[model samples]
Target: MTGYRRVLAHLREDVLGVLEPGDGLPPERELAIRFGVARMTVRRALDELATEGLIDRLVGVGTFVAYPKRNIHVQLTSYTEEMTRRGMIPTATVLDFGAVAASDHVARQLRLEPGDAVLRYRRLFYADGQPMSVDENFLVPQHVPGMAKASPPPSLYRYLSEEYGLVIDWGEDTIEATSATPSLARLLTIDARDPLLKIERRAYVGRVIVDFSVSYYRADRYRLSVPLQRPRRAQQHRPVLRGR
Candidate 1:
């Protein structure tokens, strides 16, 4: 076996096997010395490990075991439910809450007039005590009256279902890639211009639009998992030939 391959196998099996996620690995020179390989070989091995998602190489910061990315399945469940299903504690902090005049875009989504009052709120969500995402939501005031005055609920879906009987029947989501701004960087504890997964959703209770929300998720920590199914082909009718 070649030197780098041997070093890669040894590091993958012996070194990383004992280390927990976020645990730092030895420097390249130390690894090279320990494995009796060239420093270039050690770097190559580490690069392969990083490509396989087993480790993270940060500039100026040494390499460390990478945390497994959480899969966010495309479903109707709320963030609280999703985190709980993944065996992580979920918590939320309400950053801002107030009634505001709906903008043209938000009003169109919520089926309200542009100048109509809407409850606007911002929330920071955490999973296992780590900040996961930030959500900004606009709701029609008539549907969720007094929500601004009341303490924010742990789960908005649960609150809507139980208190107001406004269960979300369906939702449409538009997803895009975005970069974190300075303000968002502070809230999410990430560097400015870091990649983020942006999801804008319009949720409906029957035919009535209940909520329109925009969520920004750290791309490194979360990934989308969507299940796809092939559509059935339509039957083709051929012209029947009579007696020729």
Candidate 2:
């Protein structure tokens, strides 16, 4: 007799492993027949998978594999470029923007004096209509006069290059994990205390700090990916045997 474990193993290897989000699972009767098991056994296996967040069960609808979290490259790029590379439509909402005195933290990142006038802006980044991150950025106003205007350009980096002849040649990024704030929870559609990935970036042109940004991304929906390579060693002319 085929037990639920056998059915589960087969499904995990054949169906769940290959299926993408929104891909429907076969009916319980079909799975039972395919696995040579009772229908009850098939249901039990699916129930366990649903509890593990690997699949979703909808009333009057078949089960489906859940979407895995998206992995983003850890390189310096705009949100628009990243989301576009993932085949998702990217958009941003300007939550807040105005001239504000720099906080101690912002001042340190931007190399400005405390309480110095700087432009502070907040934007909500989206991928395929789902909120992905919230960014709070600060910048000195002396270089980019167009920033003082009421409306912001679609792409901040593009705007800086086109309008001010400035470019982000290099940057420093710091990453950490933290709990979501109330506003962040609401905008990110996650629980108040859920884990979030915080990124602090300082973009620079030559020796000048152009922009400093603090961003929070949903941990459950986003992940950072990086490539690793082994360093090459110097050539060894001859191998000398050491004491065993």
Candidate 3:
């Protein structure tokens, strides 16, 4: 094996196996001396490890073991539920909440006319004390009365299910990559213009649309896992020649 590959294997199996997340690894010079390789060789190995999400290299700070990314499966689940399932404590802080007149886009999503009242709320969600995402939601007011007056709950889906008997049967999500704005970056505790995962969702109960929401998640902390299936092949049909 090459010097760098040997170093990489040793780091992965020996060093990282003994180290916990956020624990700092030895300096490049020390590692190179121990492995009998050049410092650049050691660096190459570390670079590959970083690319594989096994470690994080901070400028002027040093390298440390990286925390695992949270996986968001393609399933109908609330943020609270998803985090709880992964054994993380989920919490939410309501940034803003009140009744508001629906705009043209929101009205269409909720199947209501423009100027109709809707409960609008913005929340910052955390998992295990780390900021995860910011969510802005619009709900059809008639279905969830008094939600605006009361303190917003940690889990909107849970609150809807228990208080109003409004269970979300299914939801559709549109996901894309976006850069965080200055205000959003501050709220999410991330650097300005950092990459973010944007998700827009419309949730329904039976045939009625009840919720429209947009969420932005830190890309480094979260990833989406989707299962895909191959399409079936279409059967070929032969054309018959007509006799004159």
Best by lDDT: 3
**lDDT of each residue in 1-244, candidate 2, tens digit only:** 3498887777776555688765899989898888887899999999988776677677786788865567756555667877787889999899988899998999988888999989988889888888888988788999777577758767777778778888777776788999998989999887798789998878877779888988898876777775555556884322111000
**Lowest lDDT 10-residue stretch of candidate 3:** 235-244
> TM-score of the candidate numbered 3?
0.79
Q: On a 0 to 1 TM-score scale, where does candidate 1 land against the true structure?
A: 0.84
| lDDT tens per residue, model 1, 52-163 | 8888898898998876779877766777777888899988899988998989999888888898999987899888888888998888888987888998776777788899
Cα deviation at 100, candidate 2, in Å, is 0.9
| Clash totals, every prediction | 0, 0, 0
Residue pairs clashing, model 2 = none
- After TM-score superposition, what is the CA distance of residue 99 in candidate 3 from its true location, in Å? 1.3
- lDDT tens string, model 3, 127-195? 999898899989998898778889877678778889999877677778899999999999889889988
Instruction: Report lDDT (CA) for all predictions.
Output: 0.82, 0.78, 0.83
Give per-residue lDDT, candidate 2, residue 120.
81
lDDT, model 2, position 84 = 82
Q: Which of candidates 1 and 2 reaches a greater TM-score? A: 1
Candidate 2: give its CA RMSD in angstroms.
9.5
Off by over 4 Å in 2: 1-66, 228-244
**Model 3 misplaced regions, further than 4 Å:** 13-36, 57-64, 113-115, 229-244
